[model samples]
Target: MLDRSSARDEVVRLTRDLVRIRSINPPGDELPAAELLAQRLKGFGFETEVVEVAKNRANVVAVLRGRGDGPALMFNGHLDVVPPGDLSTWSRDPFAGDVADGKIYGRGSSDMKGGVASMSVAGGLLAASGEKMKGDLIITAVSGEESDSIGTRHYVERNTLDGIGGIVIPESTSLELVIAEKGTIWLEVNTYGKTAHSTQLEIGINAIEHMVATLHEIKSKWESIGYAKDPYLSPPTINIATIVGGVKTNSIPDRCTATIDLRPVPSQEHPKIIRAMQEAVDGMKGKLKGFRGEIKVINERLPFATDPSSDFVKMAQALGPSTLGLPLDPPFGVNFFTDAAIFATKRSIPTIILGPGEYDLRRNIYLGHQPNEYVKIENLEKATRFYYELSRSFLK
Candidate 1:
């Protein structure tokens, strides 16, 4: 049996240690955090390797061997945290890992370090227990999840998934079993026009005006198309995130650019959406004079879902209540995407998103990338137990 008190203390300590190490995403310095986890896993008799994805960006892959050859169960979490914008807005140091009111406060504490720590500690405890199982338990602490899923993407590209059966992403899901998530398609649109004096309105085309018309048309076209609704997820939506055009107000702008974020459900196809957007732009060409524009794909990730009836999800549901001391609710979906977009969909592996982060928006708690981020100590303990129980049951 695992020592509950000891595991709780170790998880709290590990969470604090991880928070103190700044692995902010813009510069993505996750090497130190990766090394910390690597060393700890190594101490637990795991075959550990630290793979550097970029300069000062690293991923830690560790495996606790099973007695016989069987499928491996993988647990993945990202080490990178979004930058803490404007430190003055915080009541405590974002990196201090301060403990008060039965909560651990820090930038990444709730977003993921808390989940990471709990899973890591659970793995360590399981290793120490020397309980023989049928398959290996693989743990991956990856980088570059905040900006792009580069670390997990690189891991998928370079590694083989032959022996891995299913994956569990300990993201901030408030311990909910998330079986489906929306995918993302980021697009950059650029419009070009001749530059001239502001007074010469007839000679030079206004690129900003052209961009406005293009956006209106695209929105209208998308809204007009009928889409099938997903039972678990909301309807696919598009947002105009950012726009930049003119350098000077006195001159007609020569160019304008806008970045768009389109989130699609599993029922929607990305290529078709892209085609429709292009068609909208093409239609503007004939209707509006000198409306020259092009669309470029910045990034894309396909949405993924695992059948709730699958054995893996069923097992998770079975273990949920006993492990977390709460009733297991129906499997749900999330709007945000995760590395699972690559890890699960690439090979069609069964995946689940469950973690300790406070996701209930009504509670007015800080979540990922928010100021005054925190994770309740009670949730951390519950998550550790849940991971431990789930891994044990699944690997057996």
Candidate 2:
């Protein structure tokens, strides 16, 4: 059997090792992390595979079989993390895996190398024990979650969910069990116009000017008529994430593009949201003389939410972390998206995001995808214990 102290230490080591790998996506080099994870999973006595999704990037799915026909369980974490933009901004080397002041500090630390480590070590401990649980356990360390879920999409499309019964997404959440996590749909809107010389600005339609007007209109509708306020979560939020297009200031620009991020709950109708945004864009076109651009839906993502009173939620809450070994504050929804939507979409399973890390605020506690990201040593220990009891509870 795996000793608790030994197992915990192993997990800590796993975090540092993973952090050292520099699996930064969007110049995506997740192979190092994926390769290491595949080796680790194999050493832990699970049947593992490393399959590529895009170029050299790969995802690992390791399975441990249980004795009976009890419901199966899945532990999932993404292997890829966002690029650490400026290294000089960090106190230490971002990928150095520096352990300091009761926490491991570096890129991918809390935002989720820690979660990945915890789940990886959980798999190892199960293997070391050599005792069969009540159901099959899948340890999936996927790639590209930070970049667009290319890895997960490949896995989901290629594999069947025949044996899996439920999923546990061990994302960083400051140790609380999250009942609902919002979903995001990435969209790009383009506005077009005619170019003109500086002196004759009116001769050419200013796409930038038209874009500004359309943007204000879109934001107004987004704020007023399109608002969806869940008491637990924020009013369905809209983030104007990016905008570009234009040359020298003297030139009357002919094109402008805007990228918006929308966070919605599962119950909210996503199609209507898309339609509203489209109509809002269409309405602004008539105001411009030479406009030729049209807004189009670029990509879509599903949203999932779970009732706090449900059995699965209660089961998770039973082993959830708290201040004094009692039920903590009521669970809430996160503005971020997780694979919880995949579970909801594929199996109609009631999946809730749980484990360590924070939401709504950027803390070292959750500096995921940023340089100097970190997870507390204490938090990792707590989650390990919690997940152990949670697994045990599943049988009873």
Candidate 3:
């Protein structure tokens, strides 16, 4: 049987090892990382496999079967992290997985690999100890969470949550239990206009100018309407992510496009949200001279919430952190969206997001998708203990 101390050390080492792998997601290649995790899980006596959902993208699934009759439990974490841009801005190598100042520094350290390692170590400990739990304990190291959540979505489509009791998504939650997340809508808006030489300014229809008007209309009329305020989550927000226009300084652009990100609370519906944004873009049709524009949904994911009074949530709260031995604060809400929505909404599995690291306004830490990202070593150990205890409570 592995002792607590050994488990903690193993968690740290495993996290560091995972952080060393460059599993960045724009292209979303997680095969190498998934293979590494699969090997370790197999060594720990867990039934492990790497399933490829897309070319070069894989998810690692490991299960430690229990001896008694009880519902299965699943632990989920993503394998891919956002790309580490501008290496010069970082204090250390983004892929070095260096440990210093009581933290493990790397690209995926805080955003997730730390939590993934903790869950793996926890499952490994259970296997090593040969504990007679009541149900199966499953760990899924998924890909594409940083982008499309295709990995978890693919897994959900293939697997059933019929016997599974609950799911825990170890995203960066600062140890607080997250019961709800916002919905997401990505939009691409395009404006068409006639191109002409700069000298013939009156003859040319400027697409960029039309796009600016569209943006103003969207910000003023579209965002303010639709969607009610959620008591716990934030109000629906809109962000213009990217814009492209004009081919050359001398030519009036014929076409312009902009990408926008819309985050709405649980009360909002995707269809209504899209319609609202589309209305704003279409409003520019006759208002702006020589302007015709259209908006299309690029991507979307629904908001998710689980009843906090569920047996699983209560049990998780009671288990708390193994390190502190103190009661944690009441469950809270997270504004960010996650793949947990897939399991909770699609599979109808009760799910909660619990993990280490805090990157909110209170912390002023930009660990996720930022340079010099890191997760505290102590937090890793604590998270390992928490996952182990939670798994035991649910599965055993």
Model 3, 1-396: lDDT tens digits are: 456768877877888888888888889888999999999899888999999999999999888888648889999999998999998999899999898989889999998998899888888877877778988898899999988899999998988777888888888876767788888888898999899997888999998999999998888865566676665577778899999999999999999999988888887777776777778887787698767888898888888877878888888888884543535546777777889877755667788888875455234354688888888887887788888888877776
Give the best candidate by TM-score: 1
Judged by whole-model lDDT over C-alpha atoms, candidate 3 comes out at: 0.83
Candidate 1 lDDT trough over 10 residues, lowest sum: 359-368
User: Could you list the CA RMSD of all candidates, in the order they appear?
Assistant: 1.7, 2.6, 2.2
- Model 1, which residues run further than 4 Å from truth? 361-366
Off by over 4 Å in 2: 224-228, 321-329, 358-366
Better of 1 and 2 by TM-score: 1
Ten-residue segment with the worst summed lDDT in candidate 3?
357-366
- In model 3, state the lDDT of residue 262: 81
In TM-score terms, candidate 1 sits at 0.96
lDDT by residue (tens digit), candidate 1, 1-396 = 336668888899989999999999888899999999999889878899999999999999999999766788999999999999999999999999999999999999987999999988889878888888789999999999998878999899998877888898988878878888998989898899989999999999999999999998888877766667876688888899999998898999989999989888997788888898889888988988888999888989899989888999999898887888765558778888889898754688899999998787224343879898999999999999999988898888
Residue 150 lDDT, candidate 3, scale 0-100: 90
Go through the candidates in order and give the clash count of each.
0, 6, 0
